[model samples]
Target: MPMLGFLERLKFAQNFCKSTSLVSLILVIQSQLTLTIVPLHFSSSHILIKLSISALLLIIISGFSKCLKRLFGVSASAPALVLFNVLFVWGMHLFVIQKAIPSAANVGFNMECVLLMIGFFSILASDPGWVTDDCYGLEGAVGGTVSDAGRPCEALEVTAELSLSGGSFATRRIRYCKSCKRDIIGFDHHCPAFGNCIGKNNHPLFMVLLVGFLAVEIAYIVSSTQFTKESAIMGSALLETTLSGNLVVSTMLFSALQVLWQIVFLMWHVYCICFNIKTEEWINWKKYPEFQLPIQSQLGESYSEMAFINPYDKGISRNIMEFLSSTG
Candidate 1:
């Protein structure tokens, strides 16, 4: 009887872990899907808003660790988890529920959502840590760790002198980054997307990219909502109340899902902004003192206070730039 009881408890724990992991995975997929679908409506003004929000959120989340530690005395990881939950819920609604149904507008939305989900999740799951290259250099210089040839490497130490050069100074001996074909100051990895490394010099840009992604998604969701409403009104047939009712139901479901996803993402971004930290630094805080160091200490001269910038140029600026740059 004792043995059976123990076995049952163990099984329950294992199941719980599995369920939690699965849920997390699903949410990640949904968030990515929303991002992918958003691009389809690039022409819409809402896309710009969403992109802005995403970029802002990324910036906030990147800096969350410090805020939490100083203000609330909590781990930045806690807020990160919250943000992930928000993003997951929002993405599920936008991509899965909204796009799952068949309609002209919905079809486009769904396609974008599906693509976003697949692409985003693929990137997240692949765990492409800090990218390194000759242009950008190393990643997690301030504080983080990575596996090299089956061994763990410490994050680059940030010294006053090193900060000026945007390089890392670690106790561990310096090594060559094959991707960059040079001995990186901090020596992270090469991120192909940015054509640079995620070291001290480019961390700000990486944060910008993350925030941009979030903002774009939000804008897409808002604009799509308007289109969805118009579509339903036009397509509704009085004679077939059942069809109309179904359409309403589908819209409600999609809206609800989207709301949830946005809430989760918003919360997470809020936390990050308030705290001052990134996912990588949070994960390996103990291993690296760089993360443990105060934000004031880590910040370098190049670290601009205005890290978040609007991705798009508006008004006359945009018009003139487009006209001048476009090929006639």
Candidate 2:
């Protein structure tokens, strides 16, 4: 028992360290960026700073937009909107809000920024479980003709007839993503913010991104409120004020609005995860026999009702585990 306990502790310690590695790396990069930008922000001429920030923003937008477009055929608007929101929030927090608050709170605020960036970049960079031609068996007898990806379903057969509730069953179909020109396993939906499809491989990271955004947006609203209160109480002039009060208020309101919608989205996704249902499946439940179960109506033997029931559900705990453990 002692040995087992020691092993469990060791495993937990390792997992904890692994989880924190991204935050540590982000802190290092954030420190370097702060060192480089702070001087330019304060000492440089206003026009020069504005031009530099604008140029950097454009470069980032262009680079991400081009990559997303090439890979997923997404337009520039997606990245541009998300990047602008992130930049505006982080800029206000770093330059404007932080000045009003105590230095100790800055670390926590910076950590939130790190989480948001890590979540965003991780989701953006991840593969969404795309199925390629190589996945098909080359040596097997042909069960189907060549697919759009030039891959044939092998002799073993890729399709399966899944049993659903109420004695209903359906042939599970593989979804082909037109944007990526590939089939996706456990496909969810195409996310404009990440400029990628959410699927088995990246859905967990997408959840993390939503959670991180929620945290940051809440912090933003709180910090904005604190700054307003402090400025009113002390009657102090805005420190190194570059943006106007209206811009700050507008950003805060935007974050507030995001919190509202994101909470709804996050809760819906939570329910979906618990029930092992995908957004696509939930929205198009009528199309999938697995999601429809027969129900007897009060009108008697001749009458019946159809209800939504997720066939893939394996109970909450196992469903959550399966989702987290999915690799492709």
Candidate 3:
């Protein structure tokens, strides 16, 4: 029995190491970059120790993701996405900022990281307005007047009205997330990549995460511009060379992709915030042209009517503030 127990433990450890392999590689490279470039003050042995600790931390962080998911009893759709964000941010710091620029953990950069980390974890772990009978005053009754509370229940309250095809109205207050197999109150779609529903509660935090990450990337790009070019004549040539190189090339490519996509994402979110509409609603409008508000007719006459009205849109400034607070 003791031998069997040891075998089981060995099996578990093997599985864990396999799971954390990619994360550990990224961490080790990131740590090495930090010591070699960021501070440039650590000895080789100390850098080696730092790399070892980073590997340990990767395992610990993987365990932490599991703990957070189970503790909240949520089956995250995108655990890997959260982990990737960690790697991406660290890559920017270690590969791009540390390598290209000379700033070594300055106060402004550290504070930006502080905000980024706070927002990242909050989105990964925070509740996104799950439907609950207990909170809605449905007594000791399990799944009374709605679906089951802690299971693959879909029945949620109907508070708002959505116009369906053929003039039908959807009055459900919450959204049924087929992905989460759970009822969500004011439920946004299940963003498996985000590992949470972009629901009423933590939607703002997720938006903040997007904005903060974008800001961080923008700041890094601005700071690293001087390092990216040696002279004006070799502008495109230098970039191409960086792409061919292993370390800086990969980092540069990653930075370019991130900067482009993050800018678009941040801008779209800003539009949503200004309109005081949920991302789900906006997505539906894009996919279904019928859902969009009818534009003014060419002759200033009435065209088709809008499918529904947004009650939350007070004004652009107010909507922005509301989203900032996530009260909506």
Candidate 4:
């Protein structure tokens, strides 16, 4: 029995290492590809704006699709495609647009590295201890004994019902999640791009990345002088010229569209943060009532309004440590 226990422990350790290593490799590949494709000298603002639009669309589409998949028995691949597009665009920005040297591209790369490091450390610091089933088959709670499906049960009495009404479930147990041990707190669906759970500890980093990336993209767009270049070149021509009018109209339209899109995207993030809600949780309103109306209305309240405003405060850290220690 002792030898069997040792083997099982060793197997679990091996599996854990394999999972972590695979995730690290994928992130490294993604970062390298991003740095390779995205242009280093393009207007930071333009790049930032484009990327932000793409990310926001991906998040919304993916979040809704995931919810739909759970509600209906549908495939989750459609939403996954949206997520892929967002990551692909980001990779292009890093690799093609950003310069290899100490330029905007390098800055973006460094920021990504820092965010990824934080995510890595957060995962490591989290505890993976949890309960597990003994048998490899289904065990239904019929009568006092929990027997495998093969055994004939007297009646199907719901002794301890565990339903996946909102979340994903495989058979009788909650489906395995790579990063989190159980149902994530303030749970957002898994981010395949990040290859991690966007839960309590890492949600801050996700928000930081979203805001920082938008800022960087906006800076790039403004600095690139896309509009200025067009204006300056077009000014040399006659005012009444058809080409001049076309240039002005086109530039104006583009600028308006860009500004509107950025505002909408930024506002969405602000709303999520203020409401203390995850994108997934917000979208799946029926699933999470804690964030819904009446009980926790005034969803637009800012972080300052919350009792624990400063996440990085020493007191907050101490409390977290104490909680973890006790739980451990």
Candidate 5:
């Protein structure tokens, strides 16, 4: 029995490593393909032709992404798009922009890319505080039984345990994620980009990744100004510009679009962190009693306001510290 258990664990580890490696390989290939294929095929094409090709490309990519998601998960789509964009920008900057004027921005851009990749891999590899079978066991064996589908029974349970000192206890609400088809501790949401659930363990890493992306996008847009200015000096409209000019403009457009949404995303996360709340909690505030309060209306009748009353908030300073200092 012990040997069988060991073999099962070994098989699981092998499968995990294979999946991670496969995704990483796909990201690298897709990024390199974007850098190579676009320039070879569409760089000198007419503006209308390029636009038509781009639209067709998007449709093809959408279909490919659906296939990948079926094979992998929803997380596959975002990472693939992100890595491709990063590589395309880097390639253009190196081959076209830097040829005219080299600056310290190259070093900064390279560092940000490295950091972004590291953060991306870290989040993908880390556990997101999953509510495992052991957690189910801790909750009076509530979901310990396997169902007819050959999976553990899906259930939610709040569990508390006494500390070794027996002076204090910690409470945790386990939520069953329908998408993941498992329970997660302090479940935030399943981030399709990260290809993981944003639970208690890896939420901080997700934030760090978000910040890294914001910085990289901003830098890419700012540094591309030199190239854009040179293109403008040629007195040609955007549609009639040279290949390098068009590539630079395209990258800037993408970066700008990304920055707009990313800023809003970052601000929303900051608010959640300050209040020690998850996105799931914020969106479904009415479902959780912890965020509810009784308020009287002008008519003197009382009703649940569903106002934000987060019991986990330990003040902004400590909340920030807790979020930043977490290793995951």
Candidate 6:
């Protein structure tokens, strides 16, 4: 994308072209989303519902603003996810919260919704380390395992600094991400939909986002899916609840399907956390053979050889705690 424009220079616009398209699409779809589910007289409750949707729409627009995009580049699916999350929240507010859907109207449910938003935006707006040409000079080789000034997805382990014509300074080899064409502080994977790397720093946030979405879905389904004579309150509406008569049911079902996949994703990451390894390491474990380090006796004579170990594993409890506590 062109970086010369006023919107591009702002940095946090989260991809100007994509965001603009997203906003345009939402404007076009607004009417369809508000279509009435059943015939009924206009009332004060319906007016409140409309106002709630308008407020939520404004919030969604802000999310697409330059603020987040300037800070952290957005994923390909970033706009869609934000839109879905906003609409989902609005649906609950209109159909369930407004009508007081039994136990669904409690503070706890409201809190869950809050967390759902936190995790959603936190994942999208935070920087996932991206590698760029600046990490190595133009002459450096790129991505080669053998050391050179610059290379693709690889760096030379600089044991010491060499005097240069320009100047001299201490240097070190950092992680290189070939796919992203940049050096990452702690490189992980480049998520295509997310349009960035899930590096060491932001991985945990992604985890929190996945789990939060799943948990919210579970709660939303349990309380809002019940059909009963309570439906009498809704008049011509099919069910007694807000969830029944509106397009909210479609949203809820979509959430459930999305959560099902997220459950599998969450389980995989949980195992990785317990084992103290990343998805990249797990996938390529066989390619990288493990070696044993020499062990020494008290007197300094060699006693035995220690097996290759996972340095990150500090036991399951410690591992979990460490990951949760990690800045990532």
**In order, what lDDT does every prediction score?**
0.40, 0.62, 0.52, 0.40, 0.63, 0.51
- Residues 1-328 of candidate 3 have per-residue lDDT tens digits of 4465357446534543454445545543543343222112212234345344444544565575578557865333244444555465555565555654555544466578678877765565556766543444532222434335544333233323233322111222355666766566556567755556777777777777877776776665555444545322113443333321223323333344556667887787678778876666666544333345555556766665555556557799997776566543
Write the residue-wise lDDT of candidate 5 on 204-273 in tens digits. Answer: 8888889999898788777776766665623454356565665675565556666777899999999988
Clashes of each: 49, 0, 5, 29, 1, 25
Write candidate 4's Cα lDDT for 1-328 as tens digits. Answer: 4465457556544544553444334443343333322122122336455444444443554465457558864433322332333344344345433432346545765566456445443443332222233322323432234334332221221112222232222211222233443434334456554445555445555555555544544543442244335444323344333432232222222333445565776677555555434466445444332222333436686433212222212354564453334222
Query: What is the full ranking by TM-score, best candidate first?
Result: 5, 2, 6, 3, 4, 1
TM-score of 5: 0.68
Per-residue lDDT tens digits of candidate 6, residues 64-170? 45454677653224446454555555556555544546554555666767776676555554566443444455325333353464453354322112211112211
Compose the digit string of candidate 1's lDDT tens values, residues 17-81.
44344544444344344343223333233534545544543455436545745786543222223
For all the candidates, what are their Cα RMSDs to the real structure?
Answer: 16.1, 12.1, 13.1, 13.7, 6.9, 12.5
In terms of lDDT, the poorest run of 10 residues in model 1 is: 304-313
TM-score head-to-head 1 vs 3, winner: 3
**What local lDDT score does residue 143 receive in model 6, on the 0 to 100 scale?**
31
Model 2 per-residue lDDT at 7:
71
Once fitted onto the true fold, the runs of candidate 3 whose alpha carbons sit more than 4 angstroms away are 1-92, 95-107, 135-156, 159-173, 230-246, 284-308, 325-328
Best by TM-score: 5
lDDT of 6: 0.51
The window of 10 residues in a row where model 2 has the poorest summed lDDT is 164-173
RMSD of 2: 12.1
Question: Candidate 4: global Cα-lDDT?
Answer: 0.40
TM-score, model 6 to reference: 0.56
